[model samples]
Target: MIERKITYQHSFIGQQFIAKLDFTSQYHSLYCARLKSLKYRCISADESGYFSLSEIMEVKVNQSCLIAGIIVCTYADRSSIVEKYISKIGILADRKQSTFYNRRKEEDFIYLEDESGRVRLDLKQYFDWENLITGLVVAVRGVMRENSVLEVIEIFYPSADPPRPLLRKGDEFICFISGIEIGNPSLDPILLNLLSNFLQGNLGNDSAEVAKNIVRFVILGNSLYKADKENSFEQKAYSDISADIVPSISKSLEFFDTFLAELAGILPVDLIPGEMDPSNSSMPQQPLNPYLFPLASRYSALRSFPNPYECKIDGIHILCTSGQNINAIMQFIDTQDPIKILELTMKWRHLAPNAPDALGCIPMQDDDPFIVEDLPNLYVVGGMPNYQKLVTEEGVHCITIPKFTSRQQVVLVNRFTMESETLSFVSVIQGMNNC
Candidate 1:
C-alpha cells in the first residue's frame, strides 16, 4: 500500500522532506530516539564539575585562571590542519584567520572555541598530556599571554555522578543482537536452534527464566546478507539463472519474516537497517518498508527502526548504530581498539564528530543532531568483528554487539543494574551438556 511520498532531492543535512521526521527542530540521531530532557552541566575546577562554564569565566589577560570550551582547529578540514604544533607552542597571532595563520613559523595553532570566540593555545609544556581528542569539552588553567596565546597550562576534565534509576521489583533483561544475516548459510546452525529454544521454544530451568525476563530484543542491523556465496549475478545472466540459483533478498525476507514472527510471538523485536539493506545509503537511514514483512507485520510486537536507534526503556537510556560510526572513527584514529574510541567519543557529546570529513554521513549543514545532548545509560555498536564490553570508568556501559554470522554471542544487560554479560549459544549448550 503506497501512501504520501516525501522526497529527499538533496543529500545535505538541512534538506527538508515533509516525512515523518521534523527537520525544522532539534533532530535526534541514528534514527532519532526522543526522550525526556534531563539536567546536565559543563563545569570548571573551582565550581563543582556541575556548574556551567558560561557562568564561571573569570580569567583575564596576563592573569592565571581556568576556562572551559570545545576544542577546534582554525581550518574546517581537520586533515589539512597538521598537528605539527604538537612539538612547539608558538606565539598567538593578532587577528584569527579562517585559514592557516603563521604564529612563529610553520607551527600550527590550536584554539579553545566557546560561546565568546576562539583563543589560541600555547601548549609546549603540556603537549605530551594534551593527547587532546577533538570535540571534547575540557577546562584549562593557564596565563592568558599578551601575545593572545593561552600559555602552557593544566587541563581539567568535568566529572559527574552516575544517575541511578530506580528498578522495578521484578528482575528484567534486554537482549541486543546485531548482523542477523537471515537466510545466509554462513550463520551458525547451533546458534539458531539455541536462540529459537531459549527465546520462543522450550528451554527448561534457568534458561526459561532468562527468556521470560528478556523484555526487548534489538537487532542492530544487517538482517539480510545481500550477496552471499553461490550467488553470481555476473555469471548467471538471464539464461544461467536456471542452472545456478542466485541468492534473493526476497528469500532472505522470507526467512526473516518467519524468525521475526516466531520471536515476536514471544517478545517484542526492533529491527534496524544496515548498508546492505534496501534503505538509504546515508546515515540516519529510514525504517524499512513494512510491506516486506507480511507475516511479522501481523504481530504488533515486531517493528523496524532506523540505525543509530535511541530510546529509553524502564528509565534506561540506550543508543545504538550499525558499525558505520565505529568503522569511520577507527580509520581516522591511531588505534583499532573500539572501546577506547567509544569511551572518548562519549565525552565529546557527539556520536560522529569527524563526519563529513573521514566519514560518509549526510552533511547536516544547518544543525548537527549527532551532538549527544544527554549521555545514554548504554551504548551499542553492531556488526563488530569481535565481541567486547566495558562499563566505562565514567559509569556508562559501552558494548560492541557482534554479527551473528561469525559469533553466536549476544549481549544480555540486566534491566535493573544496567550491567552487561555476553552469552554465546554454543557455550550455553555445552554447559547444559555438563549439567
Candidate 2:
C-alpha cells in the first residue's frame, strides 16, 4: 500500500461552537446576527429597480418598496415553547402536531422582519412559496398594500460565494459512511465487519486497490445505537437506572471503539456526532469526547469534530454535517428532496437557517457561526434516506450519504475531479453444488 501525501487541516479554531452561551438572550440575537451578515449579499442580488430598499417602518401604503430581512413563518398549528411546557406538566392538553404546516394553508402567514419592525407579507403572488422557510435572509421587492401588508413581487436570495480553487496535485478519495448504527440489535454484524475489512484492504485485490486511494474515512454519525427503552420507573430513579443502563452503554462503547480502531489504525478517521450520538443536542454539535473511545483515542489517526464539521483537504474546503439540519428543515417544508434543501442553504449563505426555530442551536449573541462565509468544494450531509449527489453551478459538490445500516452503501469521491460514486456491499450466496 502506498502512503498518502495529501495535506489535511481541520478548520475549527478553538471552541467556536462549544462555548459559554447566552442563555438569557432569546433566539432574537441569532436572527439579528444572521440578517446583519447576509443583508449586504441580499441587497447585491436584487437586480430589479422597481423600488429602492427601505426599512419596514418606512414603507408607505400603495407605494413600491424593497426591504431585506429574515423570513418569519407563522403556522396555525405551531406551538410556542410555553404552550409545550405547560402541556407537558398536565396543565393543558398537548396541542403539538406532527407537522408544523396548517391544514388550511391560507392561515399560515409569512412575514419579513428586521431590527426596525416586522411587516406581514402577502406571498400569494409569489411563485416559489415552497422554497421559502423561516430564518432565511432574503430581499423582497413589493408594494405596501392598504391593509399594511407587503405584496411581494420578487424575492432575492444571496449569491453563493465562489468555490475555492483546488490547490493540490494528486488524486485521493474521501469515504463517507453514515448511520453505521452500531449496537442496534437488528443490525447485521457481518456488514460492519465487511466494511472494516474492505477499508483495511483485506476484502480482495479490487477492493484493496480502491481502499488504498481512500485517504480518509469519515463516520457520519449514529455510530452507536441502543434499542433499550427506559421505563417510567427508571426515568424517575437515577441510581437504579444507571445500574441497568451503564452495562449497555459500556458494551456499545467497546464495540464502537474496536470498529473505529480497526479503521483508524490503517488510515485517518473523523468521528462526527449526530442527533443520536453521545454529544450536545444542538446545531454545530460539539465533537465526541475522546474519552468515549478509549482504544481509538490512542491512535493519532483518529479525530473528532463538530456536527457541521468544516475543513480543508488538499486545499479544497469541505463542509459536512450528520443531517440534523436537513432533517429539521424537512418537517416544515413541502419537499422531501434533501439536495434541494441543501442548495437552498447554499444560496442563502447559511447552513442551518432554521436553527433556534425548528432546530436546536447554542445561542450566540454576536456571531452566527452557521453562516457560510466561504463556499466549499464539497458539501456532505449524512444519514439521509438514500445516497444522492449534486454539483451546483457555483462548483459546489453537494452529497447526501445514506445510512449504511439501511442501504449498505458508502460514498467515494475523487478529491480532484469532484466526481462521486456509491459503493455497496452484499453477502455472497452459496450454491447447492453438492446436491
Q: Clash number for model 1?
A: 4
Instruction: For model 2, give the 10-residue run with minimal summed lDDT.
Output: 231-240
RMSD of each: 11.6, 3.7
lDDT per residue as tens, model 2, 1-435: 334544655444324565563467787777788898888788888766555779999888998888999898988777777987788688988774546754366778889998899999887888887667899999998899999999998888877669987655555788999988777776788788888888877767988888889988888887876344532211122233446566776788899999888887888898998766777666777788899989999999899988788877656778888998888787687876999888777877888888888887888888898888888889999989998888877888899999988888899988877788998874421121233
**TM-scores of all predicted structures:** 0.66, 0.90
Model 1, span 55-159: residue lDDT tens: 123456687656666555443333232332432244432232222222343444567755556787788878443335344456766778878788856666544
Name the candidate that leads on TM-score.
Answer: 2
Off by over 4 Å in 1: 1-124, 127-131, 136-152, 155-162, 166-169, 183-185, 203-206, 226-247, 427-435
The TM-score of candidate 1 is 0.66
Reference-based lDDT, residue 165, model 1? 51
